[model samples]
Target: MTEALAVPRIASPEERITSIIALASSVDGVDIVVAAHEGFTYSVQALNPEYEIYADELAAASAVYLESSWQKLTGNARVILADQGGKALLVADVGEGFTVAILGERQAVESLLDPVRRLATGAPISCPNCSAVLDVHTYTCPSCGKRIPFTATLCPYCGTASPARSCPNCGAELMLAPGRVEPAKAEKQRSAVAVTPRAQSNEGEVVSEEKGETPLLIRLTIGGGVVAAYYASSLLLGIDPVIATIVGAAPLAASLGLILTEKRRQ
Candidate 1:
């Protein structure tokens, strides 16, 4: 047994990065974890199955760009938080050209700051809200009975206004107020009103055409009668009556044919 010596295997850079991401994914509510170095994506892990579709987006090199841009803007920012509707993004620069990103619910991502920093940098960072308890209480919509965030003033699922201004968990008074209208519904109503003028103008044009048709017909009939009377007077002046009758009826026949064709096409 002493003839052979054991050799320890060393993990590659990609493997090391993957292991870091795997550790980060152990936190509750964390959906995706991504690691990148020097503008190159090393690994992407989706912890939540429902969030697998967005994994490709997190693996892009743009994350590195975003980290650099944030550092430039803040002049020494190590961590960044961005809110994306129902979800949020947390990017931390763990030094040594290594950057880690986390995507999850807003409250979940906020709670992950200290743990993520400690795992990635071997040192913990201070966060003012890290010690505070996260708001995990959800409100039930009166209309749809769907559970929504405690801070939500309007139910996104049913567009109903929240009736309670107190915490559902501890029955404490909250500073939230009822929202007048849902933003999405208001935008849709504005768009519908914006197109109403165009639709009304189109209908007006149709009505004007319909009303003017009778006047046009009356004018054409009167012109044809006048032409017939003029030709009938020519017969008294010694012109052939049959020729005069044909000449007077020719204009009226052509007008009728044109009107019929237009109506058929319409």
Candidate 2:
């Protein structure tokens, strides 16, 4: 059997019946085939005498066979039927209340069944990323919009890399899809932006973030003022050390509070 087969669609009842016969004959080991109409009134059967089955009886039998076979397969545990002589029957859905009969030995018939099913059910290739049906010609997965090859370990669109269990670079237990946009990674990036002493462009204006280190002059000035005030209150004013410390901290706390109060952004 050929690798590719077209799934046929017919416009009319007559055309659908004709198509069933055409499809049946296309497969290997189809010694005799029949296409039964919706009713038992008319049927089209291949008039080959090599296989000894009456056409009228076959036409009637095929209709009943198609109906009963699928039910039996569903109901039974083994899901297959075989006669004592080793002759077997295999059935599959060809869609549209129509069935194509293939007459052959059990093994040969079974082999052709899956390939015919591929044609009838459409091409079976699927996207590993999204499970969407993939077009035979294109490597891009249409569903998730990933452009990676089918056998690739990672999906290029969604940062989903797999089968490794975890990321080597970050040691993240799960990197997830859609690249470094994952919540944990994104939060890390935000933290990086906040800490790094770099200027960022905000709508054509340069906005530089301040370095976390305090200025040397400001540190020296504040330290000198604190020591001088403490000594002056203790030695010159003749106040107790505890009293001087409390009094000194009162003004300093007020001044620091005034300076550190956050400005509201409008």
Candidate 3:
């Protein structure tokens, strides 16, 4: 028994071709591709080329006819392949150039219609600096030497943004696209922690800090009392004055130690 493959249904031609182009682009060696209308006028509505196309290709007619026949009869798409030196094959949609047949390589794009549509419709975001589509948020513009912000209001280098809102460099007002300007958030109230009271306690703390005289005076008094006791004890004992001096100095030392400790506690 063999498993049957699911038939791809395309109700919308534009969406279907878009899916095909996206799939083809994923193929290795695919440079660019496009899908357009199935007519001779050749006004391309969609294309996935390496760069912006200035004019239509002369070889597009043959490719267009081949793919259009497949699409109409077999419900399948066709590809027009081109080689740019050693790079990927540039695949274009056969009929209208509204979709891409494939872009990477023949092997990679064998079953690729679904991918083309996804990619074409969901295009990658482009850089405001060099117009290169970026994968990640970056500060340095990959194409130009510009300092960009993580969340920039304007480009730091050229001072420009998409939709031409304002010149980042010169701060000039720019002509913006319709419905592009986002409304800014209104200012919110500050947190209570941010506000500090100016008034302070008056309990011997010198509401304002100044030179500490109380500590100095206490230290001076202690020194003076110790000196006086030593001299008096030396004169009175006369025999081994050092012992007498130590005895006399004990009380004064104790008082001074208590006073210093008390001041520190307060």
Candidate 4:
């Protein structure tokens, strides 16, 4: 009979971070660990039990870290790194920052990069507002104000009431408009329309988008007004019979353009 070999099991990133923290506490320096993904709040922690912080405070720290590294991280990715002579570890990321790294004696957490990277690649984030899958850095809704989390609800700056938590456009809080189920559904439909390809034979309803008044109409109206004014002035000056005809023609041309433009758009 062949002797069975014992297989070594790898520790998960969370486990590794915990282990590193324990060791760092017993030695010199502080350790920090962070983990963030879609639908998950950013977090920060100090390894030493003596270093206590409130949940809100930790969230603030994590948010700061995420904002600072926003430029460097990938979407739905995770990362883990250490500072303070391996005494601190920061696993920072939102969607793409789902990394778990340890900082300690270099020998204690060697070769952690590969595992952390793998974990990040395997785990993606879901949007908190709509539960749609999203990348780590996607703070704005891809469907709405193109802004997500920040603009759904009331305006953060103006303290205005909005329907959701983030804005659809600039990610500003939605205040002027109500975000009910119907509006949200419409927005979602619009986004779908943008991405979906159509087949010539597959009939679908063509939704009309609201647009500003036609430029032609504006021009025509302005032209007509100008002509009327000129004709009145000409009458006051006793100009020739041709002046009246030209004025009448201008108004007629303007009206025609207005009607045609409106009909074509409709």
| lDDT per residue as tens, model 3, 155-217 | 434445543333332233333232222212111123343455532245335732334556556
- Scored against the true structure, residue 259 in model 3 reaches a CA lDDT of 67
lDDT of all predictions, in order shown? 0.56, 0.42, 0.40, 0.40
Q: Residue 176 error for model 4, in Å?
A: 58
Write model 2 residue lDDT over 57-95, tens digit each, in one string.
544555566556543221121112323124444443344
Of the candidates shown, which would achieve the greatest TM-score relative to the real structure? 1
Off by over 4 Å in 2: 1-20, 39-47, 71-86, 90-97, 118-266
Model 3 bad stretches (over 4 Å): 1-9, 25-29, 39-51, 58-73, 76-101, 105-266
Best by lDDT: 1
Off by over 4 Å in 4: 1-48, 52-59, 70-75, 78-86, 94-111, 123-266
Clashes of each: 0, 3, 35, 35
Weakest 10 consecutive residues of candidate 4 by summed lDDT: 132-141
* Runs in model 1 lying further than 4 Å from the true structure: 1-20, 61-77, 124-266
Indicate the residue-level lDDT of 65 in model 4.
49
**List of clashing residue pairs for candidate 1:** none
Q: 1 or 2: which has the higher TM-score?
A: 1
